[model samples]
Target: MTSPDDSLQLTATELRMATFRLARRLRCARAADSMSDAQLAVLADLRMNGRRTISTLAERERVTAPSMTNTINGLEEQGYVTRAVDEDDRRRVQVEITDAGAELVVETIRRRDVLLADMLADLDFTEDELTTLREASVLMRRVTDR
Candidate 1:
């Protein structure tokens, strides 16, 4: 005897929680030398998009300029990223991921993929069930992107 609005609210809550748990599980499957999540996030972005300015990264990561700088500093200390003056504009500084950073990201991804693959395999889901899960993942991504 629940109203439609209440049912929708419950569904939304469930979806949010499910996604959060899954993300947390993946995050936990990192390498022993994995950097902080913030640092990793910045490195991952740089890896994907080449070099980026501090302001660009700050905006993209929804963080303050100082916060991004601190994150960048930590990454620099670990040799995961390097900052250099922009050749096109000496006034600007650009950050780029080093080879070590790229390797760490790849290794972390492999670990997470292995963890997920093993767990999913253990579940022994039927083909239809796996297909449904894949479709649901796509739908959830669409929901997020919107």
Candidate 2:
């Protein structure tokens, strides 16, 4: 018999795989054709967290500072983001999403939700299964909240 700890590890692995797959599929539903997934991810983070320094965003995104800088450069060129001297600390530059970037994030989320809903409908899952999924989402959020 599998130990309880082994079973727990198996469940965690399955959860991680399922979450990764769903996120990968949703990533295909972006509103901006010019934006790479990483760029949009940083944009969305900005929209959620407000202004942040490149180094901070880099750490949160698990990327090198230069990579984050490149991502921000792309976003800046497209007018999706702007960089300015931090008022509190002029030595540091902060990045914030432009109104256009926020709109893009909203639209992309809308598209992803629609696609996900349609996919779920096609599954024709029982009510209990759908409820379980909804409950699982809440649990997932709880587990991931930082």
Candidate 3:
């Protein structure tokens, strides 16, 4: 029989792999004409965290400042985002999502949810299995919150 420590290690590996695969599958559900992944990430970040400086966004994304600048420029051209000089510091520019950007984020989520729901329906999971997943999801959220 496996020791408690061995069981914990196995459980951790399984959870990691499952979550990674789930994330990839969800990405596949994105709309074909939607913004690229990186652009969408930036938009989502802005929407969730409110407006922030270009430099701050770049740091969070772990990309070069110039690369982030280019991404922001494309988003701006498409009217998905707008940049404005910081009122407190004219030299600093802050980026914010537009109504179109927020709408895109919401729509993308809706599409992914529909896809996931259909996939889950096909699984025909038992009530016990569903309850276990729900509990695991709550645990996952607690882990992420830290």
Instruction: Write down the worst ten-residue block by lDDT for model 1.
Output: 31-40
Q: Which tens-of-lDDT digit does each residue in 1-146 have in candidate 2?
A: 99999999999999989989999898889898777888888988999999999999999999999999999988998999999999998999999999999999999999999999999999999999999999999998899876
Query: What are the candidates' C-alpha RMSDs?
Result: 1.8, 1.4, 2.1
Give the top-scoring candidate (lDDT). Answer: 2
Runs of candidate 2 exceeding 4 Å displacement: none
Give model 1's clash tally.
0
Write down the TM-score of every candidate: 0.89, 0.92, 0.84
Better of 1 and 3 by lDDT: 3
Point out the higher-scoring one by TM-score: 1 or 2. 2
Q: Clash pairs of candidate 2?
A: none
Is candidate 1 or 3 superior in TM-score?
1
Q: Give the poorly placed runs of model 1, Cα more than 4 Å off.
A: 1-4
| Model 3 alpha-carbon drift over 4 Å, by segment | 1-5, 32-34
> By TM-score, who's the top model here?
2
